[model samples]
Target: MPKSPETLLEQEFGLIAELVHAHARARPRHPALIDECSRVDFGELDQRMDRVATSLQRDLVDVGDAIAICAAASVNYGVVFLGALRAGVAVAPLSPSSTAESLATMLADCRAKFLFLDEHVAKTMATVALPSGLQLVRLDHSPGVRSLEAWLAPAGSVPVPVTIEPDAAFNIIYSSGTTGTPKGIVQPHSMRWAHVRRARNFGYDNEAVTLCSTPLYSNTTLVSFFPAIAGGGTVVLMPKFEAGKFLELSQRYRVTHAMLVPVQYQRLMDREDFDRCDLSSYRMKFCTSAPFSAALKADILRRWPGGLIEYYGMTEGGGTCMLLAHQFPDKLHTVGQPVTGHDIRLIDEQGRPVPVGSIGEVVGRSAAMMKGYFNQPDKTAEAEWYDAEGKRFIRTGDVGRFDADGFLTLMDRRKDMIISGGFNIYPSDLEAVLFQHPAVRDGAVVGVPSREWGETPIAFVVLRPGATASADDIKQWTNSRLGKTQRLSAVELTTELPRNSIGKVLKRELRDRYAQASS
Candidate 1:
């Protein structure tokens, strides 16, 4: 690491707790968090996190034990996460938007003895079946749940200190298994440390103030959130996202940085008064976790002021690719080359290396790879690929071809591809044709089971505001432009598509609902 004299954070990368302590002492009054419910400065955040660590030890919680938290984004949410790190305990963050049964299953997967809940989560989960002898406490008051305040240690209480190593478990983030039960992806301290180190290139520092609207549990959000705090910068959190409000905060806080998904950019750009905001302070912005259209990238580059960079990687921490859209406008259609220290390559269905620039699945190896899926060694192994010399790589499940320039142009997810008349069809190709129409605002194509073709392409689209072009009109217009095998059998008009918490379109939900409705 390069030497810097800015703050202790530059030198305090061994454990996360030490960095928090350094920030608290160096700049006590620095605003560390701005959340929907409350704002906390560096000193108060450190003290509260210390209380949590001490409280856990007082309750006989041992180091390396897991603490489970299912809650909305808040200052308290940040407290629990930082505190667990302080006490050398791993935290399991469950998805709040998951079904009750699914949530219960994940809780069992992590095997946490104690579960923490936000007040709102307590009301809904109060009826869900949980393991016997597992204690549940709410962050704040709830009608029928125990409050966390009663369990917290005194303000001056100190936690027992322990040495932390690189390989110790940091947190378990569950995968969004669109097909079945989710698997817990175990990230270690070393992996997290690598993330912190990688962040330096993005310019996260004491002067930086990051705006994070997405949920804290999602790794999509954390890739940006953790870096700011680790660098002793303030993090502004939003409980929910609204375009007008997002711009308003950007103007009010002179927000220096943000990590938003592609959909949020679409909504912001779609606003009529988007250009009116005073956003000159923004130094950098990031997008990931969903398909970012080339057109949208061009539009944002034409309008938004900040440096826009898109990241392409899995939450499992395989090799990562970065597209600096601002610098490579000609390469807007492609996600940029692999990040440093990451070896990315293409492989065929049989795991054989494809020729350079050929379309194949993306597999990569990196220093930041996950420890493994918690307690699922076989499932963990299933996601890895071993090269000829036996170096391991993680499968990205997406098909793409690399250009001579080393930029990767994605075709479609392996599971999302359609086979019609024994020919492969990429939905993105069909969607690109659909987006060419002036009336088309946002579009997605899914392969639906068909009697004649085995599986056929079906398009769902949201039209531009005030546009009245019919679905049949779009279907005909798009089909005329696409190749025969990739043509959409039908186009459905909708106000909006189903999406998850992080703004990823829920195509599976659409397939299930529409397929049933048609049947």
Candidate 2:
């Protein structure tokens, strides 16, 4: 018989290096990564990573030192990431497209010592003044920067030895905070392996050809990548997600699995180019970050005719719940039941468990949860807790409910709820109704300040190409579906909604922009 969730986690937790080494030995000849530039096998990947490890040691990089990686998705980035972890150094992978201000803030927050940047990003970084105690190295080319190629040059000898513990920090992923400054969610080596185990159970297998359309720096990519590697599968990397190119690559590479946000799906489905490419190669499709409307979900199922999976999670907690296509017929809006080893509960504001079907905060305990925020003990303590049963659970800060069948239906973020004319409305509920319109491609409902109501919802919409619809038309469409108080008072049309690295709509940024324009 298989071990229980507690026993399985207890035994496997914190052994990332060992796991990777084992995979290297087992599947050395297997294709590990395929990018636009080249494809690398496990044997080559292992050898390159070892060389990177030796280089870091030669540079006198101490254990636990922060190594920031600022590059696009490539084989070099993957090798450097694994090498840093193997050398017992904390890795922070920042988006290559990030602004100077954002990059500087993350560098200072993590106290990163050495940076590995792409040639283009290096040129940009050279113009900015770096913080004290920092040194920059180019992954491709730059002056005074150690090139990744030169650093990994043929060296038959290994350097100083390093030891890594399960609980030790592995990586710091910066969260896209809706309110405050972005916090670095510190994940340990063991938690990463746990993520791999969970991902394997979630459906990544040896035969899977996982498509890497999302930014590798995001948690969605990290969770998917490690498992694909563990299962001896190949990862097809896309520099960035472009709807037409995405479909072409999927068919060309025969990609069997993929992860995407709802907005991407909406955009792809609306494009005329979607019909020009073949997508029958995709077998597994997963989405996260935000809820998808029933109409959108139905459209995807009709288009792909493949498995569709929905996962509800945050940067802090890897994945709390998952709903698969098999379960969609009945639990259409549900985020699915808890995976093995996760204990879930919906609680009221007073910290008491709410009755079934009551809207409340969703909290859970799992092996995939992050260790804590880096160097922020108070924030960590506030977010983490041990239940009366001694199971560790992290507060999700999302308002949701469990149905009689024990499936979870997320209502909205507690902070995202809108109040208008002394009435409360959930943006997701309103957005779901708006998505039913044939003209709407993608939409985000945000609370804008109002003179009468404390805050009213204003819809920002992206219409389907060649499908024209006015703001008033959409407003009337929503008003018919929602209550008088829940109706949107205004609508704005845009080509695209502003999104962060992970494809999450930055509602706060939208609100700020609207406020400025109105003032």
Best by TM-score: 1
Question: Per-residue lDDT of 195-296 in model 1, one digit per residue for the tens?
Answer: 887888887988998998877878877888788888889999887778899999888888988988776787788899999888899989898876677898
| Per-residue lDDT value at 170 in model 2 | 85
lDDT, each prediction: 0.81, 0.75
Q: For residues 1-519, what per-residue lDDT tens digits would candidate 2 score against the true structure?
A: 433322333465644444555556766787888888888887777777777778777777888888899878887778788878778889988766555655777888898978888876776577567889787767654567877776674755454568887778889987631112447899877778777777765556657799888777777788777777766678888877788888888888788888887767877888887776777777778887655666778778877846898877767873378788655666767888887677788878888788887988888877777888887888888786565677677888788888888889887676676645323456876787788889999999999876444477999999999987899998998777554446788899989999999999999888998999899
- Candidate 2: give the clashing pairs: 14-190
lDDT of 1 at 1: 50
Write down the TM-score of every candidate.
Answer: 0.80, 0.76
Query: RMSDs, each prediction?
Result: 11.0, 11.2
- Compared with the true structure, the alpha-carbon lDDT of candidate 1 equals 0.81
Candidate 1 error regions (>4 Å): 1-13, 177-179, 417-519
